[model samples]
Target: MMITQVRRPATQLARLASLPSAASRPTLNTPWRRFASGKSKSNVSSHWFRNSFGFALAGTATYLGYTYMNGDWEAWIERQKEVKKEVIDVNDLRADFIQEKRSLKSPGVYTWGSNAHKVVAPESKDSDVKIPRRFKYFNGQVLRDFKIDEKSGAAITENGDLVQWGKGYSETEYKPTKTLIGKNLTSLALSESRIVALSSNGTIYSLPISKHDQGNGPKLRESSWMPFWGRQSTLSYRVLRPSLKLGESVTLIRGGLEHVVLLTSSGRVFTAAASTEHYPSLGQLGVPGLSFITRPSGPVDTCHEVTSLKGSKITQIASGDYHSLALSNDGRLFAWGDNSFGQLGVEFLPEHPFNDTPSALPLKKLYRLSIYSPKVTSIAAGGANTFFTVDSKRILGPEEDTTKVRDLGRITADTWSCGRGVWGTLGAGKWIHLQDSPIKVKDLSGLGEYDEKTKQMLPIRLRTMSVGTTHVAALLNNKTNLSAKNTDALDKSSDWGYEAFWWGGNENFQLGTGKRANLARPAYIKAPSESSKTPEPEARLQIMPRHKGKVGKRNVSMEQRVECGRHVSAIYSAV
Candidate 1:
């Protein structure tokens, strides 16, 4: 050992080099890492701190990169700020209106029963009873136009002012209250939780419905109202022009549970989901099987014109819970969207049994159905059913008047129904559960009385019809005499008054028959007044003097209009 130590200079130099120097190496006992054996705690801590700092810097860089790449960093920062709160003053939203003296002879609005929200007039002193009540607030005001949904109602006065009422979070308007006073409203549409109004100037206004305080359960609530006139407003309404490219004007608008269908003056049809969440389900927008590579960010804020209905002059549109129906000027019908209960009026196939799986059927586009011989005059859609009013006579040339043609002493208008009939909503007959194609409603031939002298039944022509979630209300022309020779006399004495018939679900007395039982066949609904004849037509005085006029005795009401809702019904009449 002594001899080797004297000669091992290379080994000695290697050992000296292996030992760490104080300048370059850390001490054994350091605060960061004290429990160490042979390892220098400071060195270990410095290495660990360097590696950890590098990892932390890398993690921070990665997060920043991710947020920047996704474009959410700014939004996240904005969300962290304290937002200024604002309150809407109802008085500011209202106009300075003075009630003018109204005539006793003006038309009245009558609503039957209640739904999730009560339909009582806001001016009504009685709060307990909520069934078949006349709105006294509308007594003096002439209701030029009106629309209703499950929980709300809107009307346009003859003066062009808009009136609205019903249960919403903002206010529970039991009575008709004036709104958007200076702006003349031409039309309005109501959905489950929203109201859309079209002004005479071609502007659109929307208001969010609050659901917390006034319903069976809580639902989505919008905090403010907006007017879509020229520019989009986050709190107020937005203009639906350049964004939607709806041209300069909109002619008609129809709203469903969560969507809206618009008809432009140029005969274009466009649809929009009420909210952004529904954009993925754009089939409701009438663009079937539409797929987007990137998720939309409130694209429904604007609307897309339905290309499938191109070149067709769409005149009318009707919407249900999850489906839509469009009628063209050429008497063609197009249906699309949900067909879970055969509401689309398309033939049922085994592969496409229900609309539960939208991908399988991809019923995003509208389809024209091969309806029967008679041309369709009007269409109405319910929650799960569709109703069509067809001209009973064949297509007439331009020189002919179909109204002049009488069939077997009856001027009949056929009503065809398709879709879900679980509650007899189709009104075809008892035990008919569902119909995929339009079928003429049965037992409608006897809508009028039988003429004993002619040994034939008098005709009852469908004047106008409305379909509810589970019921139907039809205004029928009850012609008493069918053999009159004078066309003028026939026109004068044809009893232009309309009788209302109701069928289908009556669980809430929506049939207005003072009963709550479902009706398989159509049943007569009594008029609000017991008078044998309706008030004399005001137009009659202009033609014939009051004393010398040959006024026809009409059992039905005059200027009659019927509208139905989820579990409620309404009638407008001039007493």
Candidate 2:
């Protein structure tokens, strides 16, 4: 009778109240209800349980809603399961191209700073060397022709063999090794990342190099591929036919950053681009304006002949980072592409309709420059500037040794530069910065001696000059010393007496002045000696003892070939 009087549990009361009606309550036969009813009841409050249950339900709803809305739930799960790429140490992959221990047997070449490996001794670690050591591999071989770019270099041997060496992938060690063994490359030209070799038969071959993705061989693509997710990806390199017509023979090959200009034996010019889709504005291919067309497609992969110069005979072709220059047989220079720096030498009118459309059509034609007296003989295009070597004899007065000028036919040329002069590259003295038209480099006169009485430096004549991104190198006229009173001194001499002058930016010691300072005026570079102390066994063994002394002392005054790269300069010494 006492047990029957006990009241119903509070949980039961609460459960009954939560239901819509008594009929909605769970049946006693339900498994969950039966299990709950059998468990020992606690004295916990119903309000606290209700609050806890509400929070748990709200959190679960929020998580499910967010995942459903984002649409990346599967991607998130995939990322979580991805395995990370293994980190590699590049040093372990490095292998020496030269022997670890070697001796310097000859002083055939010298280099400085970052790209010293191109010519410096492989076993040597010095950044600069006054006396260049000879490469053991090319000990007895003479370097016939050589060209270098920012990071790589190619040299042609007298035997028509080409050798290449530079900083390989990951800045790993790479020795100077022979390449294109049987190709018989007579000459080679180097660009930022490409090498164009001119075979003895006037056939041109190009090899493009990539600093990344060594596993994949060089592959050609219709369009440049973008990096994955905006991250830098490995670049692929390969050798391919340079967009030429079938059986086309290339007499001259010039390379730009992403394009190549080819000159045929018939004096016709053609240009080919590496990736037109990526750099459509470069106008490197010299293709006509196709603005009326709607997204034209198909084989933009071929080289296009420059139709503008149809009747003109192009004698020389040169390319900059983004522009192309062609010098006609009549000494007429034509430039096009990327005129932002006025590199094209074209003036824009204020009222000219501007479309901002980069195309090869409607080309800018420049007829005259500031130095109008002398005609331009040679043209050179740098990163953002243009250079021309003018006939100094035409500009010189009647009394300025006309006899010497006639003797050295087109040999005494003065360099005129235009466009960007940020690092005093124009060599027009310190006051002038940029020159829209070609301006004479007043300070680049020939070698001279300081006159104490007049308190002025007498200038010598310049034989040849070369221009880099922001530097200039001039070869002084050794045939005639302008400072000497007698005109007979201008007589051609076997004694190599000309001096090499370098100026402008020397940050990389490209000026070869053994300093990192920029020179507003030209500075002299000393010639490498071939004394017994500076032994060149190859030259010694090849020559008779009487001619041994004359081997390395050949005519340095004849024509000192100067070549300039990004921040480096080189002189071609046949000896």
Candidate 3:
């Protein structure tokens, strides 16, 4: 105990001890490294303890890192979800904008650069079969009738006006040449003419063949071969009479082969059949019994107060090669004269004379063929064939049912027929080859090949149609066929398209195929100088004739229509 105090150092020494000299400071040379001395053992033990503490701290740090990762997973997931939602929202908005644009467009109205209607030009048999320049049509006209003459080399109107392809003053205003030069018109029938000009006032006039073509003027002379009567303006002219009438100031008249039909401003229909008192054995008068009689016939009057039959109201009268068709005031159609082929419709003929005055034969039974108990809307006649339509329900199936078609109590019947061999007129493909019965043209069949097992029921949508002694012409509303939708009639490798088709005799290029050969099936007709093509076979339907001209606005000529028999006549309304 006494010795312990003896070794105590001074204050300065104590301070010095707290701050050990550089040399006395703990050297790296420690006993802990020796691995042998007791002091070394103590140092080793302390070092081991310090190392253990550091290792424990590192382990704790690692454990804390794992814990942080596991506990913060929800936050990380939420952030990821936020980013994904933003991307999804942008995509959805873009898709919505695109869909909206598509819905705003209009459906089918403007066809790019085609007539959409009418047959195209016929295939050229030679370079001599030149294609003509076509003009875009004005509204309201649906290709009523047309004609082409290879000899004239120029297409003119039925009124004898130069409507297309000429030089200088005779040319049209636009790209295609269509000029209307005043000429003596012989008459007026739709787009055709037979009216003549009154030479006195340079006024165009029309009359029955019984009337005189007299009067003299700068525009016309009584003896002039042409029959147009009117004054001329600088560029064109003003019609003194667009149509012809019976008395003083009548304006329009129509001739149906042996019968002459007249229209008055008062909306009256005056018919004058060639009476059997003037001409002898002439088919131009009336039916056979009256063929030798040649006097004006009648003013077959109606009680209805209707004016525009829409082609229905006694608005028109046509004669087949040997038949007659009359359009009534309310669209009721009446036919008489010939009925050999049932062109007079399914009816019984009266064995004896029915009346002294010209009265219409009632044909209410014709409605049985249509859906809407058809009211005769328009009528077209062929040589030995006749076509008439009534406003009624559409017919497409074979049931021949009318119950489902009757809606307005009034319907329309549009039909056509033709004689045998000369190919007559009905548009039905090859059906009239030698048959004498009235046959419906094949309006439903297209020009393409099809199996009998898989045939489509086509509807005839004709705007206008006409017939010749050995041929027929028509203006059809271009329509799409629905046969492809019929599973039983589907053509696996063939996709039939919409087009203008014609069939029957191609003789004299009447079918416009530029060939004199005959065609029993429908053939495609091309447009002059046009690249567009008609769909073959299935798309072809009738042998349409082409005539270029204007109607309702001017004079007409005798050549506009050719009268051959007691009921046969051909009209070129497009002149």
Candidate 4:
């Protein structure tokens, strides 16, 4: 496949002189004498004048006759480009990652709220879900890990398969269907029209909700000359090429309204836009010069690293519709993108409101607790608001194990909110315009119980909070018995029962509290009344397994796990 470069005839003259040939020997002696005469009335060297014209003619003739100069070289160059464009699936996932635990089957899920289609429903035609009711459409979390937005949703199932559903998928199937069966996907990120999946081996794949939204065809097979018989399988996904440029594989993936944020194995944060064909991106992609004015030209399938966060090791990421939040290992949080709604949790100038640069929020100044300084433990984000849980609770021995709090969505420290106020998202119980700074949620702050039996306040905690687009729900944890000491025997988040409380908008009864009036302060969401209950469909009713404890095992059950999406709310529990 080698194509030699063509050389001009003048280069042959240099080799001709080194060959000890008589005709090619230097003859400068006669040319210098002619120049010294000055009779030619010209500044040009007589030696060059006599030899240059002939050399130019000879070089042109020689180059035109060269074999590679015809068309083979151009074809060879194109072949090399095709080779560079083709990517091989290396399956290069890093080995040193946290191991995932196996989840039990037939986990029960309760859902309420509405989207454009109102797919999440209670029994019968009741529009309002003022009470927590089991969602029978998808049969609970058949998919272990899932994420949903205002328009679409994606999930990674227990068997490492991918499932998708929502409005963006209207051109395709609108219901939850098994889209990818054998990818062994570990995580899912859904944007407007695309679903980015992260495999167990760290490879990333982008799948389109509709066939027309696909960026490019699937990667070429191993042999460049392989033929297609059109008999194998449907080309539904494309391999993303960020790792080819970043030189690192991705470990995590999260979705925003129109942008997706992923963390690499090296702790680097990267962001990419949804399919530009179906959605327009603001500065949400986090790239400086790639906004509306300079929208992506070709397919929007590459991940651009956040260079603004170069030196910091970002451990976690969360995002709203147009803003993004990155949490560092040292409890430092950085905010960027659209701030007009104050979703970035920081102040901006009047003239210039939105910022694309990553800026750190002053966690140390805004929030601090006594005894143990508030170090951020975890972060959660909604359409226009964010939730930060900071715990100073330190444990010394195995009795102090609390790592499951995050997996269970339980918070041990005070949580705060800052964003738009149209839907009472700030939990301030009033209709304000916006909040650009951290404000303590009254129901979630300064929470310490008083045990009259001990004549003192008990500090045992199991509180968990879920924030939706307009409302908020929490499991107060105030009802749990105080053990005063962490013990292996005192387990089961449900045994330590939770009091359900909610606040904010009630247009769709998304707050799960019966009645239409909005709740400014936290109120207990009632269980479904016997009179309001409809007959259970034979196809949907089943007897859940009894909750039992294994002698040496932990995590008996998550009976009331809270979840919130855009105008949607749900509480999931184990079977």
Candidate 5:
């Protein structure tokens, strides 16, 4: 339509220009003046022909040029419209991003751009249905990690299989029907196969796996799994320092990015190399001087049993990408190694290069940094961060007996996420690069609240969360149990009440049981709840404003395979 209109103007202008002016030219019928002008009939014909031909030629050229120019104009107009549409699309997308970001700030779950999914807990029923333990158990590779259910003594692998450990107990619903051909497992760690399991009576076993054999079938060696360090590379003149001594057996194993640390129940700490000469990866090993040693050079350096620390027993230890955390029974936490991101949670210490050499400076000369002095109950370490949950404010003396004391419940300061880089893993979208102090994830306000009148601006309680290489998986306690009709916890019915919700990272199936889409925040996982008997919709990310209604309906069932780092382990309390 616009093209036709544009061509009409050029055609009209060419037509007007081609017309002769009657005042400028003599009329052809005025032949009396033609004799005096010496005009002939042939000349008259030639003149008429020239005028007609010239007019035709001029009009054709003008029309052709105008057509070409009109075509360009039309093209420009269309290009402008396209550009405007693109601008609008970009603006809408940005606005959606901002809205989703704001939604994440609410206490309930929300999606960013990843494949986050929501999970609801089942509603309470007056009558109890007995689900056989055997039905819950299956035989599979304990890929990431395995944990024993405290109540049932059933071992669950990373692949979601539950295996019964004891004799006669294997007949329960939680037990795998078939016998597992390999190791009688205890516990498993992700990325590395440094399995920590105990024999029936109480003998601790550690199985060390070489990197080359990560995919091999489960093979258990009945000795303490200790990794010894050989001499440093001769090609480099730099002398590597040794951290943990392997002469002593490892009682506890925690895997980090590239490095692994072993802590004896007796309170001694040992570590081993994470990298090889072939390739060097970051977070692969502790600082150069912090490498693992086969033998201690001296008594002070020897990895002997620690009986000191004011008689406080060492209960737990956590290793981060570069740092290590130790928690004693006394509730005091000891940290060493990298301080760059403040994973140590120690404040006042001047920031230094995150290496063993820099952190090895004299204590008196180095600034002492303090982060939190909470009476720690447990600690967890991630790629470049560490988290510690504490028990109470008033730390009890090691000699004090509290078995009879009423549990006042633990006081956790608030959840915080800290790390390096710009991958948007930390829930706090604004923070980037290394952080020396822990920062609470943004948009996590109002967790565990039941009513708008009682909504908390800050989370009072957070439980059971895991951090991946780039995302986080957390199971939050709603603080109340009720029917499925309650939508306060992510508009989720009671069916999803106590289950789990995943947020962050959609590129990989990190969010679990959802369409592979990256999310900006947390969302409910609805697919797992759909029974195989019912027709289910196709899987998709829940980040969009409206859920796709038809996709899943056509496909009765869809199964998604997720590869968790070796295994996904969590601490659960069966109430």
Candidate 6:
């Protein structure tokens, strides 16, 4: 088509592109660069596109250098200072929990640690208690089975009256409000929003916290209906007549955040939903059907028996906030529910983080408790940890007598523990969580039994032990090993052998060892100061009144009680 001597546009463009590569095009001025057909990029330093890229690269380097000058994130920086918790030998913690450990004769109640919400009496002082001080309100009252937590407290007085206190429990922030929960209730347990009590005649009762927890709260609700769940709130403690076989009656009861564990006199184990509509089933119920996937639609009033341990005669039972343990008469230990911190005493598996079925702890294979089959006589669960007292060698000395006067206190067990190891709560050392096997709590163990050959009492025997979320408290019965000459010169002061030894987490000064630092092993805690009014500003150390009582002298020591809650510790030493 050269009729008019004009070439097609494509042909003309191709001919131009074929011209000498570098001498053909001209440069344009704009925000961006545009290259012509045969031109080579020469003065790109002045080009807008190249200049913008250079500016971006330089700015990136400058920002990186600025970032390097400053510290990393606050959390990261703090994390660097934290060394993984190792086995710290707390030489002070395991001195002993005492026997005959009841101050009922004088009824002294001591409270220490986090006082937030005034869970303990002296409500005016809002500061955390750094030392164990006698509880203010109960001067003349005789409270038994006294249990408390961050929110509330419940106890059965000597008169068989049920009382509740705290802004979280009965809305009585400053005083102990008497709540006639149920007639003849012997013992009770407290949770954040629920309270459970057991009657001597094998009945169960429950009380829900009205002010703190909305009754039948949303999460615990069943069905989508708004009114049904809302009306589920209960004010008075009502008897939970959980269906039992003809002769089955609950002999023991313990409470958790959302459930209550029941051990029947018949050696059967059962669990019922203690809280409704607010908590999810985390296998704490120990019932296969009650789980996150098949949560109950409403209040699970039925007592679902622990099926996995069906045939065994479960003698002792314990519960943490989310886990449960059952001890059989044969000294076999079974655990279920939450194992997030290895509280179940079994190795945690990623595929199975929590367990609903009861499983045995590998005592011989893993822990090697004395190279023999573990004789797990007693077990305790709290927070995310477990405590076990193995009667490895049966020490038979005392005769069983039901009379209170004949009560000689409990045996100091060979302590073993596993699970969340923070603050040395496991009593093995400040260790990583979920120890592969239960470790011998040297501080709490190694003593408590009468040496068969020596026929002599150990220095101290763990009489009473309280396992809390982050700490443990023991009332050690101080044994007298002095000669007859030393006995005559005994100092009969108000504070004899230190009444208590505390170990583990002190975040809220719960350990009451005076210093907030936790004791990985056993450490000595001073008896409360005798000074009143203006309490001494500093902690004082008293070397145990140089051994006085004769080696076999009848220990006329005043009995004391040791108890601890989430962040509170108590030593009832009214004597």
List per-prediction Cα lDDT, in the order shown.
0.59, 0.54, 0.37, 0.60, 0.39, 0.64
Which whole-number lDDT from 0 to 100 does residue 375 have in model 4?
65
* TM-score attained by model 2: 0.58
User: In candidate 1, what are the lDDT values of residues 303-338, reduced to their tens digit?
Assistant: 767788887888888888777888889777778777
Number of backbone collisions per candidate: 12, 2, 93, 0, 49, 19
Write the residue-wise lDDT of candidate 4 on 1-575 in tens digits.
23233363444854453343677565768557756776473645564575676666665555545545566567656888888655433442111100000113334456666655533542345545565565555443444466554555556666788766655555345566677767688777666567788888887777776544442445333222346633333545766656434556787777776778888777888887756454434466676766655755655566677888889988888877777888889887788877776777787467767777788887666544322455665676666777676664433334444564332322246667787777676775666577888777666665776677778654433255556667776665564444422222222322233556677888876776556677766666544322345422112111121233221243343233566777677655432
Residues 1-575 of candidate 2: C-alpha lDDT, one tens digit per residue: 32223222333444444445666545766546645677433323464588567655655455545555767567656666663323223542211101101111221333433455443434567554332234455543345577755566668866687676666322564567665556577776665555667787776655554334333544444233454434322333344344455666778877777677889877888776543224435555565563214224544434567777777788888777777788878667777766655566555333521212222221112223222244457777877777766553323444566555543332334666666777877777663454556666766533355556677544445555566777876665543223433211122211223455677777777776656778877766544333547422121001100011112433221122467777766544332
lDDT tens per residue, model 5, 1-575: 77567666766776678677978666876777887788788988898899788767776676567656656656666888987655534333332233222222221211112111100111212121111011122211222233221121233343333233311222222223322313333343322223333332223333322222223434433233456533322111111122433553345666554445556545655444333221112222333433334223542212222223325456776666556666777666656656665555544255454434212112221113222134445566665665554332333444555775342232334445544424455555553556555555534433434445545332344455565555555545444333333223222321222334455444544455335554545555542222447423333222212111112122111111121221121222110
Q: Write the per-residue lDDT of candidate 3 for residues 1-575, one digit (tens) a residue.
A: 33224223332343444454798555577544475454556666797788567655655454445445557556656888988655534433332222111111110000011111111111112322222222233121222223222211122333344332211111122122343345433333321112222222224333221111111112322334456743333232223332334443333443433344444444444434322122222232223344323333432211111122224334666755345555667766555555455555533244532111233434444345533344555676655566655444444446645566543332223453434444534566564533333344555322223334546433345655555555554555433343333222112312222344444554434554545565654456543222336211111222122212223452221111221111111222222
Error of 2 at 342 (Å): 2.5
| Residues 1-575 of candidate 6: C-alpha lDDT, one tens digit per residue | 23223224433444444444665454455214444343345655456476466555655454444444554345444665664323233532222212111131233577888877677654656668787666666654444567878776666765566776766754544367666533577777766567778877877777675544433333221233555554332344456766688988888887777778888888988887777444536688777756644754655555677888877899989988888999999889998888788888787887877888888887666343332334776788788888887755423235533454332333344778888886788877665756747778887675654655578554344555678888887655454333322233233323334345668899888877768887787676655653577333233222222222221233322334566788887654311
Task: Give candidate 1 regions above 4 Å deviation.
Answer: 1-104, 121-131, 169-175, 211-235, 242-248, 275-282, 291-299, 348-372, 392-412, 445-460, 477-496, 529-558, 573-575
Residue 539 of model 5 has an lDDT of 31
Task: Give the residue spans of candidate 5 off by over 4 A.
Answer: 1-183, 191-252, 263-312, 338-342, 345-352, 355-377, 390-413, 442-460, 478-499, 513-523, 529-575
In model 1, how large is the Cα lDDT of residue 32?
A: 39
Listing every candidate in turn, what is its Cα RMSD in Å to the true structure after a full C-alpha superposition? 32.2, 29.0, 25.8, 33.4, 20.6, 25.8
Task: Identify the leading candidate in terms of TM-score.
Answer: 6
Between candidates 3 and 5, the one scoring higher on lDDT is 5
Residue 498 of model 3: what lDDT?
A: 32
Q: Give the higher-TM-score candidate: 1 or 2.
A: 1
Question: Which prediction has the highest lDDT against the true structure?
Answer: 6
lDDT value, residue 130 of candidate 3:
20
lDDT of 6: 0.64
